[model samples]
Every structure is written in C-alpha cells, then in structure tokens.
Target: MNLNIFRKQNVKTYLGEDIKFSRTLSAFDLIAMGVGAVIGTGIFILPGTVAATTAGPGVSLSFLVAAMICALAGMCYAEFASAIPVAGSAYSYGNIIYGEFTGWLMGWALILEYMLAVATVAAGWSSYFASFIKPFGLSLPKAISGPFDPKNGVYFDLVAVVVVVLIALLLAQGMKSSIKINNFAVILKIAIILIFIFVGLQFIKPSNYKPFLPYHMSGVIKGATTVFFAFLGFDVVSSSAAEVKKPQKNMPLGIIGTLAVAVVLYMGVSIVLTGMVNYTDLNVANPVAFALQYVHQNWVAELLSLGAMVGMATMMLTMIYSSSRLIYAMARDGLLPHHFSKFDKKHNSPQISLFVVTVVIALGSAFFSVNQLTNLVSFGTLFAFTLVSFGILRLRKRTDISNTGFKVPGYPVVPIISGLFCIFMMCQLNKDVFIMAAIWLVIGAIIYLVYGYHHSQLENKNSKAEEA
Candidate 1:
C-alpha cells in the first residue's frame, strides 16, 4: 500500500506521452481564457454585498490583498506548469513532485473547486438572467428558479441546471469551438465592465468614500476572504497547458498575466462602485445594475445585466472545459476508470468526462445557493493553492528536470511565502466549509484506496521505463 500510494510518474513520460490534447491556443488566447475565468460573479455580484457587510469602501483594498495572494500562488503555478505543462494542473504537479496519493487528493479537491465554481456562478447567472428578462414579461417561479437553500427559501434552481447542461453541450462540440465562444463573450463583458467604470466614475461622490474602512481591519480581512472566490479561476488557466500553443512561454504568461488584468479591473470597478453609491446601499443581487439605477441609466443597467449573464456563461464554459480535461487526464493515467477518458473521434473531446461533469454540476447547482457553493469553492481553492505552492519546493529538489520553461522568480522563498499565505487564508474560511471539505477528502481517499491504488499505471511499470 505504501509503495502504491507513493508511486511517482517521471517528467519524461508526461512529456513524451501522446496526451491527446490539441495545441491550438496561442498566448493571447490563453490570456483571454484567464481573463475570462478571473472576471466573473465575484466582481459583478459580490462587490455590493461584500462592500456593505464587510469592507465598505475598503473593498478595493480587499481586492488588493486577494490579488497579492493569487499572484504568489500564480507564480508557483507558473513554475510547475512550465516544468510539467500537463492538463491536470495541480493534480499533475502533485503526482510528479509528491506521488500518487497526494495527486489524487489534489485532483479531488480541484473537482470541488471547479464544480462549485460552476454551481455558484450558475446561480449568479440565474439572478442576472432573471433581471435581464424581467422587462420582457418573463417571470420565473421561486420554487424552480432558486437553489434548495432553506435560508433563502429556494427549493431548486432550474435555470442553473439548464445553463450548465447547455454549456456542457457546447463543450461536447470541442475545445476550440467552446473557446471561440468564450473569447467573444469575454471581450463583450470586458467592454461592458469598462463602460461601467468610465460612466460611473463621472458621477463619483467623494463623500461616499469618507469612512473607507468603516468596518475596520476585521471587515477588510473578512471581505478579502469572501472575495477570494473572484480570483479562483485564474489558476485554472494552467489546466490548459496541454492544449496551449508554445506552453513553455504561454502558460506562465497566461497565469500571471490574467491575475494582473483581473486585479486592476476588480479594484477599478469596486472603487468606482463604492464612489457612486454608499457601500451600504450597494448590497443588492445585481449591485452594478443597482448602482446604475441610482443614476437613472436604465438602458445601461439592462445592458450590464445582459453582459453579466454572458460573462457568467463564459465562466461556466471555461470551468466545465477545464474540469473535464482534468477528469480526462486523471482517467488516462488510470487513477480513474478508463472509460471516463474516452474521447469522441469526431470532436476529439472527452465526451464521457464532459457528460459526467455536466450532470454533477447541474445537480449541485439545483440544490445549492451561490453563497453555499462559493464557500466550498473558496476553501477548496485555497487548499489546492497551498499544495501547489508546497509542490514547487519539492520539484526544485530534482536535478534531472529540464530547464526549458518559465521558472518561479525567488524560488524557495516565493513558494514558501505562497504556501504560508494560502494556509492563512484557508484558516479564514467558515468552519463549516472546512468541515465539508474534510468530508469530501475522506470520500476521495476511499475511492483512491478502492480503485486508484491498484489501477495506477506507474504502479505497474518499472522505474527504468522512462528517461529524464
């Protein structure tokens, strides 16, 4: 059991293996993808709520804190991605640096991150979608339009499930196809965000920022912990290393570059938002639109709502795409049943994996509210970041590894700081979320012991089979 659990796969095997992922994404496409994932519901929906209840005008500072943390972990991820350049992101890094058991845990945690991201974002999408269609005389019933959260009185969120399934259907078309749609939606959403900032900036009341830290340090810290979900998707960009063109150069560019763009946008939007309206008054489901309503810009509010829905749609698409690839990668390595790795010959897509991921996300979104889903996603993501950061320390110990890709600047110091920061943020999460994550990990360990341990390809192979 010890031998099976600690079995490691060499870098040479991953590099030389025919991983079946297409290489069509350029550095720019990757940046766009990263931007697509980073700028989602957190910016559009949570800004108001977090501002009113937690940070007040200091939400901008909260954005700064979260960005700093993400940048550190993003750097570590860049190094691992550059060295490994595989589809599984942290799962791949963990397998090569820490061994099979750790890899399985990372993979399992990532499933939580991506799946909850989809659910929470879909629930967000439904809110904006409902608003976007309100003027058209379309009213969705409460029973089926919201999650089964007793706190919110919602029994099920039908629109959320529909959207996830729709995106999964789109994913089945192929990665190139799904990304093209995502790229377009991302460009549109960015434009809408810019419009909001520029227009809202003109009406800024300097007085609204009077007590910027109204809730003080604890509030800002709480805001940062909550809004960290905004930064969740940036690292998922690394999951596309296997599909990226010139990944050695593009992977790091995408990961770090996305964080930079997202941080600036998040800070700018929050500053402008709080300046336009008192942070207390901005805590609505559609805060951006609510702010616009204050200026009586109904047209702009409608467009922003529409843009938000489209933006969230792209986010759902990207997460589903990345998550399916992760599942496919794990399945291919025999850490899961081989059938899940099956690809459609016509589309060259992971049909079974996509189907499985879509079904799970749909069901989760139907039952869980945005807040519940976001908590789980945030904790799981922070935990994954911790391990990924720690893995960089282990990877650096190997002298046989190639020096072809991007390296994390500052080495051990950066990863050490990154890991510590991640663990600190993990501690900030709601205790209940931490408990749920623990339960999820235990389930993953059981699955690994029952199936993954015996089926691991590396376990059945000789160590001399691959060269460095």
Candidate 2:
C-alpha cells in the first residue's frame, strides 16, 4: 500500500470541499439547534403516550432513563463532529475512517431517517391542526385529517403532504433565512411549553401518580423506546458540523447543554401533564393536547395546538435542511448523481440536491401517514451513531485524525458503552421495525456491491489513470 496515495486521497476529501461555514456559532446557537430538533412530537405528544402505554404516570422515570442513553451517544458524536469538523456529519466521519461504502451507507440511511422524521412531523401537524380548528366545529374532514389508517382508522392525509412540500420550499431558499426561521420556531415552541407548565401546575392530582414506576422494570424498558424519539433531534447538532465556528469546542457544549435543558423540559412536562389527568386516559396520538383537554383547559389546548403546528413546520424545516446537506455531500463523491451535489453559489445551499430531496419527501408524504410510513427513524440514527461511537475509538488510535479540539472523556470505555446503549434501544423496537431496518441495510448493501464498489472514490481514478 502506498502511504503517499492514501494521504493524497485523504487530502482531497474526494471533492473540492470549500470552507463555507462560519465558525460564528456559540454554544447557545448549537443548543438552539438541538432544542429545535428535539422539541417536536416527542415532548409534545410522546410523553403522554409513553406514560399511558408503558410507565403509567411514571413516565418521568422513563424520560430520565432515555436521557441517560442520549447522553452516552451524544458524548461520542460531540467528540467526532468536533474532531472531523466537516460537512456530512456522521457520513463524513464514517467515510474518513471506514472508507467509501460505509460512508455512503451512513449518508443513505440518514436520508431515510430525516425523511421519515419529516413525515412524522407532518402527521403531528395534521393532527394538531385538526384539533385546533375543531373548536368552532370546523376541521378537516376524515379524508384529509385521519389519513388512511386501518389500525387507527384514518382515511388519507392531504394536509401532511402539503406540510412536507411547504417546508421543503422554505429550505430551498437557503441557510441564513432558514436559520432565522428555525430560531423563531424554537422560541415559540419553548414559550408554549412554559405556558403549559405554569398554567397546568394547579390542576395536578397527586393520586394520578400513585405508582410512579407503574410498570417497574418492564415498563421502564418500554418507556425508553417511546421517549427515544425525543432524543432524535440532538444529533441534528452534528449535522451542522460543516457550518460551526470552532466546532471542536462548541459541539460538545451544544449537545450536552441542549440535552440538559431538553431533559428538564421533558421531565417537567410529563409530570405536570400526567398529574393533570390519569395517565390511562391520555391520548397517545396527540398526548399534550388531549391532556390539556382532559383538565377542561380547552383554551390552552387550542393555543398549544397552533403553537405545535408552527413548531412542527420548523421541525420539518431543520430535518430537511441537514438531510439534504448529507445527500449533497454524498452525491459529490459519486455515490449518488453528481448533479445532486451542485450547490447554488448565490444561496450557499445545495439547491438542486434539495429539489430532488423534496421530491422524494413530497411523494412519500403524499402516500403514507406518519403511522404507516415508517418507525425506523430511530433505527437508522441508532445505527449511524453506533458507527460514529466506534469510529471515534478507532480514529483516536491513528494520529492523522487527532487534530480535533474536543475529545470524549472515557475514550474506549465511553464509545464502547455508547455503542452498547444503541444496540439496547434498537432491540427494544417492535419486531416490525427491526425487520424494516434490516431490509434498509440489505438495500444499502446491494447498492454498495453494484455501484459504490466500482466507482469508489478511494480507487482514485484521476491518480490511477496517471499511473497507467
């Protein structure tokens, strides 16, 4: 093996990657990014569901356990993102350490994660929109609202499709404007949640929390899976690695600080909301609104509903933003069409790439409801994270990648434990989700064997032709 060739390939990053991101983001901005991504359905909807379905009012415990898992994985990612400080987030990390196929696979799985995430947010928005407008007895008909669910009894969701496209158009506009929009959305969402905590505190019934750990050990495990979705948005912080100023120092601070605030918010909301009504009667589909409705606070529910709809819009925006960037990076390396990698110099965004990404999202949302579309957002992310955690441990041993400012505290132990935690949560997923995630992996494998292997940027066609 020629060390010089290997070094040269590493130097190019397989693309004329430019330093476009401003290192101006402080810890606060990164924390805002995490909050924007994490606050969606998980906090607004899932806690009630987790409490009712698994923990029985003891959902606060479930959230704490889930936060522990998130903390472990977040530490590893913070280390990698700071060390690499490049575009593509985990996709770049995997590529630099594991080679082309693994890298592309990570990037590809990320698309699935973000797409499904957007779909879920769309579904959430649709549900909240219907709930909000129902007061005047005006709401979307079942055909548009319920969204074709044999299990939950839905019948086609037009609103969801519309929402996905709307967010896509916003992101296609570019990053500066997108960031401003996201900032506003994040503030609105946090304010709404604070209102719920303050106004709903008086309604708490101590009897509702009788058995805090209602399900005990089994319940805790179930709650972990339910609330794991809340932890989903923290990784969006890493997706901004390409744009961060001093990504090394800022990434970890952002991840830890954001999760800390998010956890406090999650725990507070779960406790107050469940205490307002027995966890048994809380609506899993639209948990927070249902809880507010339970306490006869119809006005609060309506207010939260509007807030939620706007918040979901921001959620879709941020998810699409990071995912589209990953696709652009992957395309530039020839893993996907080169055209998809073209950045709009004026907008400083991958405009063509976003167009294609939005097309896929629009089509998916047009057909699938949040429930039926997929439950594997958590799965793909978990898999990618497992790669990143392990990658940090592997890369740390090689000096070439050690120029990063921030590093994980426990080295082999921290990353190894994080990898284990990822697998644990993955196993907790439903069998159907497990099978579906496996199928996605198989598809990635096939693509790698057929195309990625032949066109591998690692083979260095430019340099190879020179040698020939």
lDDT of 2 by residue, 1-468 (tens): 322212222523522363654445567777877888787756777778778888888788788888888888898888877777777888777777776667777877888899888877777777777766776889765555645665655656787778777777877776667777778888888898999999889899999888777788789777877787677878878877777777778888988887898889999999998898888887567788887777788888777877777777877887888878788777766767678888786777788878887877766665575665456887888888888878877778766655547787877898898898888777777898878877887898787667755555554644653454
Give one clash count per candidate, in the order shown: 0, 6
lDDT for model 1 comes to: 0.84
CA shift at 190, candidate 1, in angstroms?
0.5
- Please write out the lDDT profile of model 1 over residues 137-243, one tens digit for every residue: 99887778887866666689888899999899988988888888888888899999899898999999999998989999888888888787688888889888888
RMSD of candidates 1 onward, in order: 2.6, 3.9
lDDT of 2: 0.76
Question: Lowest summed lDDT over 10 consecutive residues: which window, candidate 1?
Answer: 459-468
- Model 1 quality (TM-score): 0.92
Instruction: Write down the lDDT of every candidate, Cα atoms only.
Output: 0.84, 0.76
Q: List the residue pairs that clash in candidate 2.
A: 23-245, 147-155, 147-156, 148-154, 148-155, 148-156
TM-score of each: 0.92, 0.89
Question: Residue 442 deviation, candidate 2, in Å?
Answer: 2.4
